[model samples]
Target: MTLNLFSQFASPYLLGVPLIFVASISPWLLLPSPANRWMPNRLIAIQTWFSKTFTKQIFSPIGPLGHKWALILTSLMAFLLTINLLGLLPYTFTPTTQLSMNLGMAIPFWLATVLIGFRNQPTASLGHFLPEGTPTPLIPILIIIETISLFIRPMALGVRLTANLTAGHLLIQLISTATLALLFSSPLVSSLTFITLLLLTILEIAVAMIQAYVFILLLSLYLQENT
Candidate 1:
């Protein structure tokens, strides 16, 4: 029974092939393509506006050096946002919920920022591992601690997204299954459970959006540090 409850998190397979890629890429395919006309249609227009607005809000606080990443970061934000929201649908699987997939993204982006910092300003990068005016004895300890913290950032990013989405999905499944079970036995209780499920679904939607934003925002913050 416990294993059955967690079966949703398992990747769906057909004919011995995983459908994770299809699930991830389908959202992008559903997006509206731009027309050759001077003005885009309403869907495209809204997409453009949202992308521009998000890019501005995210990059406004970043330094000029970080501004160079605007396009890549913005696209990543959009991709994450789309996949997360789509995954909330009844039959869809969220690729972001997979820790392996999330880590794949987190590591490269975080490493890139670190590499950039090292290339452009090695002193500043290394300086992050040790603070100024450190006491002689604690200096080594502090440096080791800071270095560990630095390496932990990417794992934190990946685990945060994975854990949040996984927990939400589990709760939703639990409530939904309960609601179904109680329907015939107790309509009133089932109705209440159903209402709670609705509210939970709405909150999950917000969480899905926010988690994506937070992921990119943290990456941008990392970029800001290195830049």
Candidate 2:
């Protein structure tokens, strides 16, 4: 029974093709494209406004040099936001819940910031490893510790996203299963559980949005430091 519950996380296959691949890319189609008319429809307009607002907020802390990432970062935010929200619907798979996929995204973006730091300011980048005025005795140990922390950033990003979504989904599943089991035994308790499920679902929606924003916001901060 526990295995059955976790089976939901397994990638579905059809004729030996992974459907998760399709699910990952499907969100792109949901995004509105530019209209031929001078005035776009409401959907396009809303998308534009949201993108602009998010871009401004995210990049404001970053210097002008970091603004170059606005397009890719904004698109990533939209993609993640759409995927997370869509996954909340019944019978849908969330790609972000997979550590592999999350890491795939986190590593590249994180590496880009690190590489930018190395390219633009190599001294500052290496200086991050060893602080000023450190005693000679502890210098090597601090460098090792700081280096480990630096490398851990991408893993943290990926695990944080995967863990949050996984926990939320698991809780929802457990509560929902209990609710269904109690439905035939005690309608009152079942109804209360259902109410709790409803509230949890709403909270998950907010979490979905917030997680996406946080991912990008952290990336922007990394860029800010490098710039």
Candidate 3:
């Protein structure tokens, strides 16, 4: 029996819903257990040592915040990385490649950065929407531009991942389908389609990794800006 790739289910929200919960509650999960309440010092020592060694090796210039950031970023990366890679598996879906899922992740990160910036520097956060050295007459226009640009981040993130993955998937499916059809009708066309599909599959793997890294990199940049 032949498999129907298009018949498979691939809902972005369904895949991303759990990721949202995991990201939201990760900090609490990392807190020390109640049994170790009396040994707070010990826990702190362990965490400090781990942070020093790991942070130094992985994210040198960032220091202690690097450790916390690493944990947060890794969690996000793992979730997205898994979804992106899983799409290559038979009968599985890649939620990270979906616009809804990518936007769901990016929007929260953008909002979190904005909220953090506001909490850290309320007045300055608004000022950030304006160009640094603009004249008074052009400040309003610059602010409008900046505001639109700021809001566009999530949209851009969504479109980038979604379009790349969806396009790749469609290409693969077309090649495979055409190959099978040609194999029964014309051998030469079948061979070419097969080769094309093979190359596209390899390219898609690279695309998956690049998309995941890009997502995490943008998130890190946003966090750093707020900090």
Candidate 4:
């Protein structure tokens, strides 16, 4: 449980970065058509018939944008959540618990927000940073605050994810160490520690899902606000 910078750097954490990158961005490359334009009605029909016949087939309830978006978001979530959970396993590292990896994901998302907003509404997107109805004296302060808030999005996103994953991992490690230490020192204490670690493992699974949900929810909210 001693913090070892070199140990972390030497682990497979670095490799997860590219894996996550590919998982997040590969869908765009594979699916060349715009989400809005890509229709799978024929495919859907085939799937629906299969579902009806087998009673164990898959069905897509949403349109192309919704489905593609779901796939993209799920891919991201899977990579990050898997990385986060990996730390629980012996000899594995969680890349998402690292600041660099979290920032890599967050910064791109922030840039995506800006690019999407501007692309959707070239002139009006500026209005998001500077609202129309504002008091004359307060305009400067509002603009400054808005600008700061805009910049803080990525910072918040990165810090929130990294902090959550890091804290969870640290807590698990602490409990695990405590359990090991107590095994020789006190059986009762060791048993309690084991129980706590078990409970925490379950909680971490929920945390993974919650974190994924939060990231995608906030992302969608940002998109909705701008567009």
Candidate 5:
């Protein structure tokens, strides 16, 4: 009973071994593969449309140089979108809810962009630390602050994803628990709570999609600065 209540967010395991990798990769297996024929099915058509639309949205504002990232960014969004929505299913675990997992994905991408900027435009990259014509004493302070903020990007990305999913899951568990507890005690309250849960579920679905987009969108913004 206790396990069922919180296992949705906990790292999954059979006996003692961790099943996080399995849970994390399960979402991708559900996606449909493209057919070999000329004409495509509805699902393929919809997937292609979404990929194109998302790629355009992310790359449209940025320069053409960064357009190459369309495949990577779009695939990332699809992966996150799948895992997040799948987590909402009964008895399922969400890997994105883990801060470690999110950071693992975020830091490398963020660092790669920073490295790209350094490699391509060293002077410009360093210029981001200390602005033009800064006061002597205040220069150090500003550099320190900017450096800290720059490093905070990955942490923020991981925390943002982790916190949103964690909060939503916890709330759903709490509300659902209250609903079940009240089922026999108070039918009126239980029914209303159930309806509220329904609404919250819908909201979480939207949140899952939006969070995935936001993650990719921010990465694209970072890539824009470098590319």
Candidate 6:
């Protein structure tokens, strides 16, 4: 039997049940609960700081209209961050690596923002499709283009996350295989390959965090447009 480069991306199952649920819920349980303290420990403090900073920064641009989204946005950011980093651990599954799951999360939020825009101000929301002072000939074409782009946002979000993670995982798998294959045949080459693998692992960790931030950031931007 041989290892498949793509096999790691396949969703793991036990008996008849999908493990994604377990993978998703397990990370949250690890978070430390807040307790009475003059000052909390660094971990709790950092988490609190990030939550406040993210909430404030994300909601600032959108003004009061977007304040209601703070809870969902912060929770989503935390969830994504935890899930992504956890995947890097040995034998862990990454739910965000699946386009289906990403899109399932994306579409509803994207649709909600669009709905908010339309619900609050129908004229302004539709105005995004066409700018003021456009030539009659280009108006139709531009509107069509904008509409297409509008709908494409959710797909783009899903694919961006999936592609980045999948590519990184594949690359890591290939490099690790190469490193092992070279270990006996060429010690020097194997050492270099192992070093590269180490660097790539660090880079992947950064990517996991960044992709989560980008996911939340883009959602906030969409809400900004609506609000």
**lDDT tens string, model 1, 89-115?**
988788888999999999999999999
Model 3: CA > 4 A from native: 1-67
Q: Order the candidates by TM-score, highest first — what do you get?
A: 2, 1, 6, 5, 3, 4
Candidate 5 deviant stretches above 4 angstroms: 1-7, 15-17
Q: Which prediction has more favorable TM-score, 3 or 4?
A: 3
Model 6 clash tally, residue pairs: 0
Lowest lDDT sum, 10 consecutive residues, model 5, at: 1-10
lDDT of each residue in 41-145, candidate 4, tens digit only: 664555445334422111133323333344455556545555555555676656666677778878887778678778867788778667888889988898899
Tell me the whole-model lDDT of each prediction, alpha carbons only: 0.92, 0.92, 0.70, 0.64, 0.90, 0.90
Model number with the top TM-score:
2
TM-score, candidate number 6: 0.95
lDDT by residue (79-110, candidate 6, tens digit) is 99999999988888888888999999999999
**Residue-wise lDDT of candidate 5 within 1-227, one digit each (tens)?**
77675667678688887888887778778778889989999998899899988887789988877777788888889999999998899977789999999999999999999998899889999999999999999998999999999999999999999999988988898899999999999999999999999999999999999899899989998998887
Q: List the candidates' TM-scores in order.
A: 0.97, 0.98, 0.72, 0.70, 0.94, 0.95
- Once fitted onto the true fold, the runs of candidate 6 whose alpha carbons sit more than 4 angstroms away are 1-3, 36-38
Alpha carbon deviation, residue 99, candidate 6 (Å)? 0.5
Worst 10 residues of 2 by lDDT: 4-13
Query: Model 1 segments beyond 4 Å from truth?
Result: none
Q: Report the Cα lDDT for residue 89, model 4.
A: 67
Model 4 spans with C-alpha error above 4 angstroms: 1-71
TM-score of 3: 0.72
lDDT of 3: 0.70
Cα lDDT for residue 198, model 5? 99
Model with the higher TM-score, candidate 4 or 6: 6
